[model samples]
Target: MRRPLARSWTNWLLALGLSLSGHAFAAHAYAQFGDIRYPASFTHFSYANPAAPKGGEIVLVPPTRQSNFDKYNPFTLKGSAPPSMLGMMFDTLLVGNMDESTTAYGLLASDVSVAKDRMSVTFQIHPQARFQNGDPVLASDVRHSFERLTSKQAAPQYRTYFGEVKGATVLAERSIRFDFVRPNSELPLIVGSLPVFSAKWGLQGEGPKATHKPLDQMVVDIPIASGPYRLGPVQFGKDVTYVRDPQYWAKDLNVRKGQFNFDRITYKIYKDSTAQLEAFKAGEFDYMQSFIAREWARAFTGRAFERGELIKAELPHGNAGDFQGFLFNTRRDKFQDVRVRQAIALAMDFEWLNRQLFYNAYSRVRGYFVASDFEAKGRPGPDELALLLPLRAKLPAAVFEQDVPQPPQTALDPTSGHTLRDHLRQARDLLKDAGWTYRDGALRNAKGQSLSIEFLDSSGSMGRVVTPFAKNLEKLGIQVQYKVIDFALLQKRMDVFDFDIISNRTVGSEAPGTELLERYGSRSADVEGSGNVIGLKDPAVDALLDKVVSATSRPELVTSLRALDRVLRHGHYVVPHWYGAVHRVSWRAKAFARPADLPRFYQPEKLVTTVWWSPHASAAPAAQITQPAPKAP
Candidate 1:
């Protein structure tokens, strides 16, 4: 879902509270709301320890279920690249701090300047920046990276993300400018975040015979880029290691001063979660962030734990909750009716699952933007109403008449007499009203077509979670098929929107903008490999997305999002799941040291690999560990 800003890019920056129209001068950093926390002279981020030693080989498992990897080009759509390829091997023009949500400081670029008309932005490459091959990073390299990424061979999300940028121009050897199709304030930051690489990459042979391979065809080709790490040893699909570059161009840069502390970071591949946990107990990995509450509560214990060798701890942060749920494919006829979707959603008994399996470790997710200001709460406020009024005809009356929609409550309420039986009755009634009735042995439509759902997943562990729900659906006479396939097949099917129902999680955003378009926009719904996996294609949602991106202030942005959230909830596109408040993690004790000041917003694994340092790293003449910031699960 990573893409450049387009359409409302200018308005999005304005909504961030940036006061700009013209006559903007270059600066060391750019903040969404024009409020830069760290001054230009700041040494390092507060979350990082500049004086800490760095030297360690931390072996960790992939954050998500990555059974294996097949390609080196992460930008392409065809194959799976190894974990941490996005963060470890590429350098962006700007880098964000762990504590901030929307501010980014110069990384490859020393400074950035916006055009007076707000239609373009220019950046000067850091003079000392050099690629892995020791060639200086130039404006031409930036242009090449942008063009290559936007090409058809790359993933379609890249095009949808960078669709707003008109073109890129190399103003000088070290200066490049990005022209926007519209005057978008956020366009500068979006373009600044482009992953730059050496043009020599993918080029084969020498002189005239050197043929440049298409980005997708460059599979398994080692990347040549300016970053803190280089591709290290690999056991093909079994494991991969990243080695830190001692001569990394930005080793002393302010943005990188105390980060990427590991000398060698290895990712061990395990197809099964049970095997992964067993291996971790056997000292196969240095750190692990566990998501399964059963494993965290019961299994994170052994001889290593009693001897203080393995430590299990919970880390706290103020990040937004993930929007996890069982998303229904609206593009399919079975889920087209809102009543039917709501009926299906009513079958999930979160209370029973929380009490029995989860050990009461998670909170039921209610809305798309839960635990955030953008979340829709009570009836639309005046600001939200003002935005929603114009599209009254396109919206459901429930959005304006009712409070924010809540998942079916299985807990007993003496006053309302609500329970799991009541929920099942409501589901049955809703299905009947939607032209479905129990006939023969299953719920069937007018044509005797049975209502069926295949709960598709890549992990076998999901069976425990989906079994109870499937049983509840069976009570409603709906056929439930739970299938756990391999990760690669699951990914390929997902790319083509080839599933009836699938469980997925989307990361929450603090300053959400154009990315919303790719998630729920009508144009992106048809684009294969786009984030709109639920196949939502609503004109009303599309209009709300525009309002969200074009919002002029923080209040306006919040209002627009609230309105959008209300509409999305009313649509019943997903059956909400649950989220944990604290990050549950386990690590080998006495292996790493971290700064006392914790970041306000950060993933557990990112903090572990990037900010934590080794006590004996400086002991060696040149530590060879490479730190990688893998995504949070």
Candidate 2:
């Protein structure tokens, strides 16, 4: 998952250049790797249709566990916000093209430059950039965005993401500079993705005097940021609509062109997935990105398909596969033992679950950053060894002595010897070795403490998914309890790192940067609401994370990540889950159309909101259409 890059770099990339005074070196675009598909003079993104139509509204049921939204603010950690709030209202300094994974073109900032020392990056605000209230996007606004996001008032992820940034300075009326803690290659691009909004947002406008309020208390405040849309209407906690701005400043920009096509986008909040899918069948919404394999295979049939009003398609994407599993909160004493964690993981009969529950719709998730260059496979190479060798004392011997551990395979056929029984036997052995044994009905430690687990969740809908695993744990003499609490309550619990195990995942990145620290770093392990849910605090992991963030080249980055993957795998922080081969989706056929070339790496809602348009409107319609969601990013 996309994480934060926070700290002083151990190995700063040294690119030679002269940091001359008043020597402005500007570019219209920037790439993590030095390849830009669209030149500076380009008028539109390759994936967007310049003349696509707008006007028709698209209503959707969000794929979140929360049934309703209580806030307009999307950046906070407390409450849920509508899906269209962030992308529709706020704009970032740069916008990455979907076709290419690592390139970003100017969005809010017209020109961007990096200092020769790579210690700072500068941005010149676009002359045409304007807020929804018609205020010009000033240098102060950029600084305000950075300050507020990195401050205590905003969400912890922002602070963790931009933590390495030393400070944001207003260079001029239309220019700003962001100085870094160290000169890293990806810092500029990371800073470019910062969401910029008018400082006037979340203010208490008393007559003519708008009083500034802290971001933490600005939960339900209406935002005044500039984007394609503004808050149109709301039905309390039921639904929220975003109205497209007719005079949006960046509407004609090359980076925008044919995006944000709908005149109005609405979201209907449903408490249950079954109800949500039924609503789609009844034409209450335009699209449904189904995650339940049973619902996708069985429920998406009947009248709509028979009348050619609905379409179901499995869309392919090349994005990094998202890792989802039972994330162990390592802060808990019971989970601190690696052998106990390993033993518990051995009991997930994925083969049996795949055939019985998921209709064999998933492939085993092998490792973090799976299907990417970062995933550790086969053996540790010479480059990875260089990094891993120094941390041998902090890591397990198996990391250097053997290939990374793969998930335990259970045979699908009845006659095969490799089955649940075989893996359970291995699990018993590991548990015995870890000083745990079946005693007085439950596994007890040396202190006579029985192994107890609570599968913490929100909405209680995942009981079916956890039931089998809990049953398996019961087989190993473990006390298993499952409880589904409120979403807000769960968030509160996770923030304080108070949990036994939680079903969670991270949004993976194409080129993982310092954000690796926020995920597994020692510093973030104790930080409340930090993404390091596993509470991983190994010095070897922290060191490898530092290497991954500051790597000058792709080879070095991959090597560092492999070293990290090996270490974490051996640690067994989470039970590896499964991934889908394709994004399974069901959308209304006659409503919207998309670009000829679908983006290789994208989320389902992202594709619908950004590129898809309605043919019923006056302008030219985009051709082709889309799939579902699963990727972390």
TM-score of each: 0.94, 0.92
lDDT of 2 at 113: 86
For each candidate, how many residue pairs have backbone atoms clashing (under 3 Å)?
10, 7
> Candidate 1 residues 189-240, lDDT tens each?
7888899999899988899888888898888778889988887778776688
**lDDT, residue 472, model 1:** 92
Overall lDDT per candidate, in order of appearance = 0.84, 0.81
Itemize residue pairs with steric clashes in candidate 1. 9-184, 10-184, 10-185, 54-617, 55-617, 263-624, 263-625, 263-626, 264-625, 264-626
Off by over 4 Å in 2: 1-25, 203-211, 413-417, 459-461, 618-633
Candidate 2 structure lDDT: 0.81
- Residue 608's C-alpha lDDT in candidate 2? 88
lDDT of 2 by residue, 431-495 (tens): 99998989988899899999999998786667887899989889999999999887777888999
